[model samples]
Target chain A: MELQKKIEILSAAAKYDVSCSSSGSSRKNKPGGVGNGHLSGICHSWSEDGRCISLLKILLTNDCIYNCAYCVNRSTNDIPRTALTPDEVADLTINFYRRNYIEGLFLSSAVYKTPDYTMELILGVIKKLREEYRFNGYIHVKAIPGADMKLISAAGAYADRMSVNIELPSSQGLRLLAPQKNKESIIKPMGLIRSGIQAKREERKLFRGAGSFVPAGQSTQLIVGATPDHDLNILKLSEGLYHRFNLKRVYYSAYVPVTTGPNLPAIVKPPLLREHRLYQADWLLRFYGFKADELLNDAHSDFDTELDPKSDWALRNLHLFPVEINRVDYSLLLRIPGVGVRSAQKIVAARRIGPLSYDNLKKMGIVLKRARYFITCQGKYYGEKSMNEHIVRYGLISGKPEIQDSTPQWEQISIFPLLPQLPPPEVRLATLTGEL
Target chain B: MIYLYDGSFEGLLTAIFEAYYRKENPEKILRNKALQQTLFEEYIHIPTDEIKADKVYDSIRSKISHQALQHAYYTYLSDFEDAGTWIYRYLQLGWKMGHKVDYHLADDRVLTVHNTSRKVFGESHLLLGLVRFKKLSSDLFYAPIEPAHNIVSLIAPHFSSRLADQNWIIHDVKRNMAALYNKVEWVITELDANPNLTVDEEEQAYQGLWKQYFESIAIRSRVNPDLQKRHMPRRYWKYLTEKQML
Candidate 1:
């Protein structure tokens, strides 16, 4: 087959995995090497779905031994299968890196022939890219499930980051759809990688210039909406993975149905909005000191699609509102709806100069429209006098306050047309129903 | 009065030096080509003086933090209308407040300089990702960029460090200058002569493969061109290998 045809098939098969970032490593180029890696990943382009295309994400082959229901490249799909030789993979990566087409390579593969065989092919490509081509760019390779730990470790010496897809959130879901794979096959490699990385770090501290093992660390993808997994289940599992494996990132791929199946949920569209909400909640868990139970619990299994997780959290806990902009601690400042990590830090720095006002907060990148209801400037509230949950929710989602506006006659007539705007019932219903 | 200088970083510094030495708050500072004749305001020609420019540069380096100096340099690269006046105001504050001037975000002049510098940095950062190099038959990697900001100098350090082993040229076609890097060092040179540049015969095949990979990677179920445009703006699509028509 032609190289173009192979790339088309392999990349299409690999796209569903959805771990596109080529970041977390700052590997500098050697004196004779051709490329370097930056700490902040550089996205080469944006795919049509608005996803960042940072790496040359492709598979060694699309031919697989197991049939995972949600995957497009399952054995029973009868798709045109192809594989790239180790030389072709290395050639493409070096040429593309020189042309500045991509930051690095994100190489993955199916269980072609056998797990070890597939891993060896991947290892060959990376080894050639590093050793032969002298390419020092970021490389993120997948550690195939059930593959030999020795081969995985060999691959890790060359790759900056590695991943083993936790295909389903739960083993029960994995059993029904992907019978050949089990949770142990996936998590065991992750555990090995964590320990390998730990050992490497210790060795590096003692012996200068020791080779790094998976220098960017490891990440994993969990397919969302394939089974009836709750957001709480996903978040808790992610929190556990972050703590246990010291994982860099937990990627969530919204399940896009590819084939008809009795076991899988027949989702017409990928739950992108739900996926987006999960990412927002996941950010809170990772960055903002928020626990999984605080964001969602057994009672609330899913996120409120109508509002962002932070805003929803604030609305649910209304007693926490009216945090004084001057006196609010950094953690509470972060919890405020409009303030981001940067802005919260800015507020902390700027308030040290003097007590900040509403204008100053807005200037410092705080979203006053959302934060006004939750915070005050010098013990004075700019939001409504009678702040109720329903009113706050309405203001948060609809961008219109429930209270009637009394515009003075002098300010009524402007160049623009003045019309009485009312909230459409469907928007109101969508907000109330907590669905977008 | 309007002060006009050669369109160079040193020239802008010289103009700032003159502004300080003469103690005349000029109504506008512009490049020679950008100067407009007004019936009311007078025009003064400022010659580029490296000695005077370096004096200002040294004072700035000593007085303000390196971070603030970078902000001023990026703001100069922004080439926004009234950017010169904004920088002048920003430096006036910087001279007084020293390093603490960056935290004075509430000051409108400081804010404008900060925001415009951010725009310049943002574009330079985006070009770091969006640049697509096509291999020339001479074995020199060539990339053409037309960024909104004068970011060729800003992005040169990044490419030089990354592609240190290969000779490469980043041509800012809009600004009519090219950063020519020869492995060890680089210099920005005027690049009007195209010289009938041609890609390697196999370059087309690899570009075709890249375009195909780009198309196939996008999920059909979630096609949102608007979001893609937000990240990789449509203005930059002309030079992108993946965005070109087959």
Candidate 2:
């Protein structure tokens, strides 16, 4: 087949797998290389739905023997399947990278005849991209389920990152939905990748590069709301995976229910917002120092759609909040509803100068609307008298600040506050206080 | 005391010398003594006095590097800061370095001015996308941007006849700054405030479509209001078509 036709089939097949972030890796351009990696996020383009569409993100081939029900490219689906030669794939990546259109490549494939056969093809592409083409750019490869361990190791050395999609949260779900896949095929390879990363880190104690195997580590995706798995169960699985494998990311795809078979539930629409809520929880776990059990339990199977996960956590654990901002620990400060990493850092920087009041928090860009109830800035309360769950939930949903803006200032709602003219210290206090 | 001079770079250069000599603050400068109707205060026209200006420039060069003096001059020319003449104080620190430590311009004061320089640099970048140029009948180009800062001078090089041989004008509606380029040379001006612009009507439609596409593509699943606020601030929304004017 012509290379263009092959590219179309493979790339279209790979579009469903949406875990394309080139941020974590910090590889620079070396001599005799075509591209560079950026710590600052860069994606070549975006899909119509504002999804990242950069990095010639394509399956090396869609020809698979596995019949996973959730996947469109499952074997029984009888979709048009094709595989690309390593030469064909490398040429396309080089061309795309040169045009400044794509920073790298994200290559995956369905099991083509055998898991070993598919992984070998993937490794060949990376080998050529590095050895022959001399391309020093970011490349993320999939660790196919049941793939041979040696081939997995070979692919890791050449790629900037490697990912193995845990795909199903539960072993029971995997069996019912994807019969061809099993627990051992997936988890064993993840263990292999984890050990490989650890070994590289240990070796780097003395030897410098020695090929940093998967500098971005491994990331997995979980399909939410597909089977009978609860949010707590899924989050538990994610927590275990993070601890077990040291995963850089765990992407939650709102399962697009595409089947009506007797075994499958009749899913009308995907739980997109649920996926978003999970992502919010995931951010809390990684950045905000939150544990999975803290946010969800057996009684609450779903995350609160009305409020974000962090806000929901704050409402439930009311005792923890109103923590003195001046005296609170870093980890506790991170749990405040509106305080993000940047705000936390700014608070640390600002407090070195003076004891911050409730007014000073907003100037540091804290979400005073939500955080005011949670943080005690030098013994001042900007929140309401009633901290009732329903009242707070209602406030979150209705877009009203729990504390009313009693002191109305012009710059608070102005189109352009004079940037050059510094607001008076009192106005700065009002800007800092969420109430005004 | 008030120090008014012929609005030249050197005239302001000399005024910086007198402001320090008199120890007058910015509030005193803006509240001109004669204009203030206060009997004890006085105003002075420093004039296009090359001797004083050259003396001030020479002393600055002797103390600070040429780069620091240039930055101070640009900051003075910008007229953004409350005290445009306070740059001389910074220049005094810069002159002691002369060359070596002048590049260590990342300190608090140097950073304050450098950061403002970046803000002006960013305004130029944003106006690149916001300024819609239209091809006029005589094969000239014209674009108008309503920027909050006087940033036309920074973006002049970007369009300088990339359509060369074609006359063009970039009118800044907010600060009333315009860059009139006639194929080769460019001149900056502050014309009378004219909100009535003559932008090509078709360019408006393309802009509408461009904005529509930008808005349509943002996924509702991840509509992070907090993140959005942290980025595109509410203040700059007036100039950007992506925002809805409430």
Candidate 3:
């Protein structure tokens, strides 16, 4: 088949695996080489689905031996099948790197013939790119499940990062949707890659010339909203992966239903917002020092669609509100609804000069609308209403209209001894305080 | 008094140097091309002096911090209308407060300089990926970009190290300059708006496959053009090979 047609088919099959980051690897170009890794990866473009196109994400082939119900390339599905030769893959990667169209290659494949055979094809393409073409850019390849350990290790020597998709959160979901695939097959390779990365690190510490193995580490993807798995379960599983396997990232793909089966859930659209919320919660877990159980529990298995995970946590833990901005610890400042990591850091830095006022916080680009409800500046409250949970929640939900013009609509004249009585004071007070 | 100088980074630094030694506070510091003379104001044309510029540069590095010097340089590259005046004001404060001037986030002068520097650095970082090179008929890879900031010189070192074996030219079409890399070194020189160039026969085939891959990789169910535009803005679409269809 023609190269364009083959790429269209294979890239479409590979789009479901959404681990697009090309970061954490810092390889320099050889004297006569063609490419180098950007320490913090650069995104080349954004696809129409709003995902960053960091790498040339494509599969070696779409010919699958296992029929996963949620996948587009299931064995029962009628689709054109083709594979790229190692020569073609290398040629494409070199030309694309020269054109500056991608950071590197993200090579994945279906179980063509067998796991070991598919992995060998992948290893061949990467080996050709790294050794023959002298490509030093990022290469994120998949560690084919149930593939031979030696073959996986050999592939790791050439790949900067590797992944084995968990696919479903639970083993029951795996058995129900993908009968041939098991959870053990997925986790075994993750364990192998983790040890491989660890062993390489120890070796490099002793010998400066020791070659790196998977310097960017490993990542995995879980198909969200496919099986009847709760967000809590997914978060717990991800926490375990991060702690046990030392994974670099856990990507949550909002299960885009491509194939219908008895096991898969009938969904019209991908759960994008849910996936976004999971990412927000994931960020809190990774950087904000929040635990999975802290964000979700058995009582609340799903996130509040109306608010973000951080804001939801703040509203539930309202006894901690109105924390003194001048005296609060840095960790407590991070727990505030609107204070992100950058804003929290800025607050800590700016406060070292002097005690900050609300105006100073505003100048530092903190989102005052949500933060004002939970913070006090210099022993003075600037929130619109009192610290009642219902009132605060209502204020958060129905954001206050920004006062663009500083001029008051109603003139306050000193000549009049009484208060300005042109409007209904009770109704205005009720609306502002969320009490009638 | 208004201080006017040739529109170069060195000229801006020379103006700062002259202001310090002369003990006269200028009302506005501007580039020669951006001057708008008022009826009552006295204008002083400060010639570009490399020696004075280097002195101020070294003082900024030694007295203040290397990071502060970078901020000053990046702020100059921003080419904002008030970038010169803001840099002057920022340095005036930096001289008094040392490196702590950058931490004064509430101060408008420091904030403006920091924000402008961030913008300049951000654009250069983005161009590291957005630059699309086409293999010429002569085997020289050429790319044309019209960036919002003067960033051709900033992004050249990156490509020089990455594509060390290949000769390439990154043309800043808006600024009418190019970074010419000859596999060993790179130099920024003036180039015409349009250069006579031809792509190789196989370049179109590779671009066609790239465009196909770009389209195929987007999930049809979750296509959000607004988010795509937010990340890769519409202004940058003209140079992007995959965005040509849109």
Candidate 4:
């Protein structure tokens, strides 16, 4: 096959994995190296899906031995099966990196022939890029499940970040959708990568010249809305992954239906809103110090489609509202509905100078519409309505229209014209019928 | 009183130094080319002096903080019309309040200078990734950009370290200048709008492959053009190889 044809097929197949972050690594360029990692990561472009195109995200090949029902590259699918040579992969990475087209390579592959064989091919490509090409840019490789410990560890020496797709939220979902794969095969590699990173940290502390082992750490992806898994379950699993494996991130891909099977849910569109809510909750967990149970529980297995996760949490715990902004702790400020990390920091810094009024809060970049419902400035309440749950919920939901007005006209007309503007009865009916 | 100086950063600093040295409060500080004369208004043209500029620079670094100096420098690089006045007012406040001026986010002068500096820093950071280099026939990679701010010099050191083994030139087409890197060091110099250079034979082929990969990677089910345009704005699409077809 031609090189362009190979890149098209491989990249299209690889898009389903959905981990495009080029961050968390600051690998410096050697004396004669060609690239260096930016600590905050740089995005080269944005794809049509509005996703950041950071790295050269392409599979080494799409030929798989395992037949997963949710995957586009299942063994049963009669798609074009092709693989790039190690030289081709390295050459593509260097040429693209030189042109400032990409940050580096994100090499993933299907289980072609065997797990070890696929991993070896990926390792060869990384070695060629690092050694021969002297490309010191960010690289994110996949640690093939069931691959040998030595092979996975060796691959980590060159890869800045590595990920093993959990494939499903639960082992039950894995068993139902992907019969060939087990949860043990996925968790085993994560455990190995975690220990390897720990060992490297110890070695680095003792000897400064010790080789780096996955300096950006490991992350995993879970396919959302594919199986009958609740958002609570997914959040809990992500919380566990973060705490146990010490993982950097857990990506939740709103399962796009590429193949149909009896086990898969037939959906008209990808669950993008749900995926977005999960990310919001994930951010709360990572930065805002919110637990999974605080966001979701058995009473609420899914997020409210109208309100964000933070707003929902705030509404549920109304006793915590009207906290005095001047005297509030930094942690409590973060729990406010509209006070983000930056705004909270600004409030903390600006308050040190003197007491702040609502106008000062606005100047500090706080979203006052939602924040006023939960905060008090100088012992004065700013919420338009009384501190009642029903009144606050109504005010929050009614505030959606003004936000929609800022969106482009076409998007408002196409997606959300009637949803936010409709009366309570029709909106409730839509919610009950799953139209929202 | 209105103080006029050349548009160089040193000239801006020298004007500020003259304001302090002469004990005259200027109504507006502007570049000589940007000055608009009004009847009965006093105008003083300050010559660029490196000694006076360095004295003010040392005082800012000593009295306020190094971060404050960086904010002053970045704010000057923004090339905004009122940037000179804002920096002057900001430094005036910094001299009084010490480093605590930055924490006064509610103050208009401090906030304006801080926000302008942040804007310049953000644009330079974005250009680090958005720059696209095409290999020329002379084996020197060349890129052209029309950035919203004067950020070519700010982003050059990053490329000098990143593509350290290769020679490259990043041409700022809007400002008619370029950062020429010769593997070891980089310097910003004036370059014409049209260089009349020829691309290497393999440049077109690599661009084609990149365009193909870009088109293939987007999921068809979640095609949000608004989001794409939000991240990579329409103004930057002209130079992006993948967006060339669009």
Candidate 5:
């Protein structure tokens, strides 16, 4: 096959994975190095399709031995499959980097023969770039499940960020659809990477002057709607990983069905809106001083589809707000609807110099349209003074989805299962009517 | 009053000092300096008076915190329309308040000056991300930008430390000036205009590969032009290689 044709295939196969930022690594340029990771400011390259394009995102190979039902590269799917030599990937990366096309590489793969073989190809590609090409750019390597730890560690030495996706949230989902893979095969590598990243970080701190390392840290992806895991479960799992493993990011990709398999949930629709809401909830947890349980508790294990996580949380706890603008701390202000990170910071900064009023907040960049409903200016509420959570929720999600679409088939799947237990269908069935 | 001088920052400070020294109100001062362009335009040929500029700087330094003066200076260096005089006016207002000015956005002049400082910082941030480097023959590096606000003063230190080893030139074509770095010294130069450098064959090939990679990474399942435009505005599209209208 022509090299360009091969590139097209591999690149297409890699698009499902996302790179949310351009702050590729914390790695700085050394004596003779050519590239350095950007500090402070993150520059992300996004495609017209709204996906991040920082990584020279591609797969090592799409040819797989196992038949994972949800994957397009499943064994039964007669799709054209090919693998690239490590040199080819290195060449593309260096060439692209020189052109200022991308900041780094995000390389993933399906098991071509075995997980180890696939990982070896990926490791070889990165090694070639670091050694033969002398390319000191960011490399986000995907650790294949069941790959040997020794090999995974070798891959780590060359990569700036590594991810071993917990492909399906529940292990039982993995058993039925992806029979060849199990929970341990995925989770073990993640645990190893967390330890490895921590060890390297500690080593660098002691060294004081280590120039290059995985400065950007590690991240993983969760395919929403594929398994019936509730939003609470997802957020709780994310919280556990964040606190325990110290992950950099967790990407939530709405599942897109590309193959037909009996074991896979027959999802003919994609839940794009729900995926967007989940991301919003994830943002609240990460930046808004919100815990996963705070957003999703026993009363609500699933997110309210009608309202955003913050608004829902606010409505549930109405007693906290109508906060006096000049006095509210930055975190409390951030929890208010429509206030962004930038706005929150601006409020804190501006208030330090003066007693801020409602008018002043507008001038400082508060989105009063959303926030007015939740907040007050010196105890004067512009929003409806009603205290009901349902009223607030109905007022919000009642509006159309922001990035609206007749969501594609893949986005709307859902489920739950313990390691070997399938996800319950009732959780995601309100909109789906028990597709199971 | 034609506030002309050696064209140094100190000279500008001297000009501002003269504007107040001659007891001329700002409007009257400008009208007195009007010249060949219009009959109403006056001319006050201010000389290179170092003493006058020093006294003005000394007064500003003593009255406010050094950080405030530095922001005023950065605002002055921004060279935006009426930016220097506004900073001059605002600082005077700040000094007049004695202590109340520190805790008030009550003054419109204060708000305007603060806005200018933030505007310059904002541009510098965009350029921090937007500046693209092209390696030239003999390892000379170059980048071109047409920023909405003058942010060169703010971002020069970042470029110096980030690209510490390379001798590079960043040309802000819109403003008709450039910052060039030698082995250790960074200096600014004014040009009548720039020679729009042509893309070399190697760069073109690299761009082709970049475009491919950029196009490939986006998943078609969620193609939202509105969202893409929100993150990256259409105004910046012409300069970005991937977002160029195909």
Candidate 6:
């Protein structure tokens, strides 16, 4: 087949994977090499689906042996199959890199012939790209499930990052949809890559710049909404992956139905919002000092779609809030609804000069709309005295107060006295009291 | 008093030098083309002086840090109104507080300079990803970009380091300057090359493959043009090969 036709089929086959970041590795170009990798990755473009096009994300072939129901390239699906030679793949990467079209290559393949065979072909491309072409750019390749450990290790030395798609959150779901694949096949490679990265770090410590193994580290993707696994299950698995495998990122792909089967859910569209909420929760776990259990429990198995995970958590744990901005610890400041990592750091640095007021907090880049409810500037509070759960949730989700009929008569009567630029009486009332 | 200088980074530094020597903070610092002279207003044309500029640059480098100088330079790249005056305000603070002024985010002038510099840096970062090259008949790759800030220099180092094996030119059409990289080193030159250069025959095939892959990869059920435009704005769409079809 022609190269254009092949790329069309293969890239389409690979799009659902959605791990597009080409970051975390800092490999400088050799004297003879073509490209280099930056610590903070470069995104080449945003695809029509709003996902990043960081790398030349394509599969080696789309000829599958396993029929994963959620996947586009199922063995039973009637789709055209094509494969790219290792030479063709390497040439494409170099050409694309030279043209400044991509950061690097993200190569995956179906279980073509066998797991070991597919992995070898992928390894061949990376080996040729690194050794022959002298390509030093970031390369993220998939460690084929059930592939030989030695092949994965060889692939790891050449590629900057590796991944093994969990596909489904639960093992039972994997068995129901993809009988040829099992949990052990997926996990064993992750463990191997983890150990290899750990071992490489140790080696580098003793001998500086001893060739880094998977320096960008490994990441995995889970197909959400495919199986009946709860959000808690996914978060728990992600938390485990982060701690156990030392994964850089755990991608949640909203399950887009490509093949219909008995086991798959009859859905019209992918659960994108659900996937978005999961990412927000994942950020909390990674950066905001949040535990998985703290965000979700048996009663609330999923995140609130209306409000963000951080805001939801804040509304539930209101006692922790109304923390004094001037006196509160940096760790506690992060718990406020609108205070992100950057803003939290800014608040810490700015407060060093003097005690901060509500005006100062706004200038420091805090999102006052949401944060006002959670924090007090010096001795003054600008939030409502009656912090009812429903009212707070309603206020936060709506993000604005109703000036029409439903607003309280007492609040309405007071609004006539205030100027247009000034906030409502509720805001002024908190300012007047100097505490809520 | 208003001072007008040639629109070069060194000229801006020279203006700063003159402002300091005279002990006068000009109400406005305008580029030569941007000057608006009135009957009563004092307008002085500041010539570009490398020695004087370097002296001011050295003090900034010594008293503050190179990072602070970079912030001022990057802010100058932005097309924000009164960005020159803002840089002067920021430098006044920087000279007093030294390197610690960067951490003083509460100060409005410090924050404005920081934010504008951040925006310029952000655009340069985006251009690193958004730049698209088409192979010419001579095997030299050519890319045309129109960025909000004069960020061609900021993003040029990235492409030069990555595409060291290939000869390429990134033309900032808005500024009428190009960064030409010739396999070993790069130089910023006046853009004399034609905008409508022909693509190589082989390049057409790869462009076709890229466009095809671009379309095929988007999930049909989850198409959101607004989000795509948000990340890759409409301003940049004309140069993007994949975006051309839509």
For residues A252-272, write the lDDT of model 1, one tens digit per residue: 988888888999897788899
Error of 6 at B12 (Å): 1.6
**TM-scores of all models?**
0.93, 0.66, 0.94, 0.94, 0.81, 0.93
Question: What is model 4's DockQ versus the real complex?
Answer: 0.89
- Enumerate residue pairs that collide in model 2: A322-A374, A359-A432, B63-B95, B64-B94, B64-B95, B161-B164
Least well predicted 10-residue stretch by lDDT in candidate 3 chain B: B28-37
lDDT of 6 by residue, B70-119 (tens): 99999999977688888888998999999888878878998899899999
TM-score of the B chain in model 2?
0.71
What's the DockQ of model 1? 0.67
Question: In candidate 3 chain A, where is summed lDDT lowest over 10 consecutive residues?
Answer: A398-407
Higher-scoring candidate on DockQ, 4 or 6 = 4
Question: What is the iRMSD of the candidate numbered 1?
Answer: 1.0
Which residue ranges in model 4 land beyond 4 Å of their true spot?
Answer: A400-436
True contacts kept of 6: 0.83
Candidate 2, which segments miss by more than 4 Å at Cα? Answer: A1-5, A258-260, A401-436, B1-246
Candidate 3's TM-score reads: 0.94
A1-436, model 5: which lDDT tens digit per residue?
7666777778888877764465646666555444556654345455777654566778888888888778877788877888888887887776555434567777889888888888888888888888777666678888898999988988888888888787677777778777888888888888888888778778888897644435567788888888887888888888887887788888887888776666666776667777888889878878888898788887788877767788878887888867777788888989888888977877776677767788887765567766776766776876554745655555565542233244575754455433466447675674477555
Question: In model 4, how well does chain A match by TM-score?
Answer: 0.91
> Would you list the clashing residue pairs of candidate 3?
none
Q: Pick the candidate with the highest DockQ.
A: 4
Q: For each candidate, report its DockQ versus the true two-chain complex.
A: 0.67, 0.04, 0.72, 0.89, 0.31, 0.60
Which model, 2 or 3, shows the larger TM-score? 3
Ranking by DockQ: 4, 3, 1, 6, 5, 2
